[model samples]
Target: MKTALENVHDWNFEINYNTVTAVVEFSIHFVSTEQYPLLEYLLTNGTKSLLLLPDDWKLYEEHLSDNEYRYYLGGCIRAFDIDTLIEILSSNFPCIYSRLKKNSIDALLHHDQQAIHGPARLIGEPDRYRFLNCILNAKKQLKSS
Candidate 1:
């Protein structure tokens, strides 16, 4: 079976600014933590100490731009990464679901509604309901399950 890290490597976040680079590199760092195994991973693995080169450091710089730095800071983003699966096993990390809802709500209010809603409708019939439900009931289901 593919590890959670490998699984997250395939996930991408399309932010409006320079977050693409930070997100990719952050994904790489999380992928490196797969060795620690489910619950123990975040606590035992040295992910917090992962080093970035100078170029990679520049991508996360606060002084570079306004919008870029804010979104890329990873405060509580919903973007898919190794943590999405890890969050299932560990409560120490922030949940992606909460962040996703914040993103979706913010998108609905500020961004083009169609841009957010239209593609969601395009989800195939069989899985569409489940997909939307997952978004709607993320926290409740997480607790129940």
Candidate 2:
């Protein structure tokens, strides 16, 4: 099958993660073949998140209203094991973080929540709790400001 993003090249985020993170949305126009069922994204942490796209990037259109984007993000983040995530945080990756530091872990949890909850609320199901609890204890501090 052909991929929706077949010819597309790598993309860049204008904003980098500092105190807050900026998500760079990925898009692929349309596709005929089933080329891209998987999306591989690298996090600020060295961890790599791989998500399975429905059939193509365009498939997102059918379920975009359900916050599938963020959910996919969570699922992708979940793809990497805890060890990998830890390694990523310790590394120099822009999204890299520190589980040891409250702020760092909070940010990671917040990042996952933004991606997962938004979509889970929209789509409904399985991915809802994935890695989300990592920051549950700190929600008040992170969300309130």
Candidate 3:
């Protein structure tokens, strides 16, 4: 995967594994300024999964400046065992499972209620919560498995 990403002239990536914790971190960097939109899209859409926990999206949003575009994207997954980590990485779509923060879990519950009763009225909170929940649950399940 690193080789595949590096093949793109505008893109570079690194994969780091922590042996003691059995965690893998995948980080991608975009070299071309023109690729900022693509970077934003990946961060916004790719991170929207129920099987992966929220990482630094919020921090990124808060700190991003108009003149300074953040060109890096990264995610970490903790595996219950080496075999599980290998299995996740070998699959078409790898993921993680981790417990949701209190606020995030609360938002998810609220979103569920709104979904069953009526449409979510907030502009982007619902989507954010949904994505966060997906990632957290995925991480949690991964750890248990």
Candidate 4:
């Protein structure tokens, strides 16, 4: 399935256990067949998060309600392991971390940052739970320690 974010590039997730900070850094080919110039973004786990759109794109609120936009945008964040994310959110937002499991992770980050409706496509699901077990097991080890 070709998602609104079909041309996803390298995406890296970094977790700072000590600082309780998680950063999702990634790049995407917003424009088809583009080279050298890619749309890069850095999303941190916090209130004043960011949704840096490409220079040619416009930002609006309606985009927030778009499924394709949400599917692509939310999928980027949702692409992370759900369980580990729950654990991470649990530590930071103890009261509402449960909602993370029940809801879209992207909603937590870029819900109301933009107002314009943009195009988004459907993304395929290929091993969405990439590091779920490893992270969860690591957390288990840490708790045991």
TM-score of each: 0.18, 0.23, 0.32, 0.26
The lDDT, on a scale of 0 to 1, for candidate 4 is: 0.29
lDDT by residue for model 4 over 5-109, one digit each (tens)? Answer: 233333222322221323222223222221212223322234422333323342111222223221121112332443435443333322110011113445435
Candidate 2 has its poorest 10 consecutive residues by lDDT at 116-125
Q: Who is ahead in lDDT, 2 or 3?
A: 3
Tens digits of per-residue lDDT for model 1 on 1-145? 1222222232222112123333222221222212211111121121231111213332232222332221122222233432432333232221121111223454456544333321111113333343334433444443454
True-structure lDDT of candidate 3: 0.37
How does residue 41 of candidate 1 score in lDDT?
A: 17
Candidate 2 stretches greater than 4 Å from native: 1-38, 44-59, 62-73, 76-80, 95-145
Give the C-alpha miss distance for residue 79 in model 2, angstroms: 8.7
In order, what lDDT does every prediction score?
0.26, 0.28, 0.37, 0.29
Segments of candidate 3 deviating more than 4 angstroms: 1-10, 35-54, 57-70, 80-145
- Candidate 4 clash total? 11
> Residue 54 deviation, candidate 4, in Å?
18
Q: Taking the tens digit of each residue's C-alpha lDDT, what string does model 3 give over 1-145?
A: 1222211234443345544554555555543322222111122122232232325762232123443344555666435333443433433443322222334544456444422221111113333344344444556655675
Candidate 1: Cα lDDT at 6: 27
Model 1 TM-score relative to the real fold: 0.18
Best by TM-score: 3
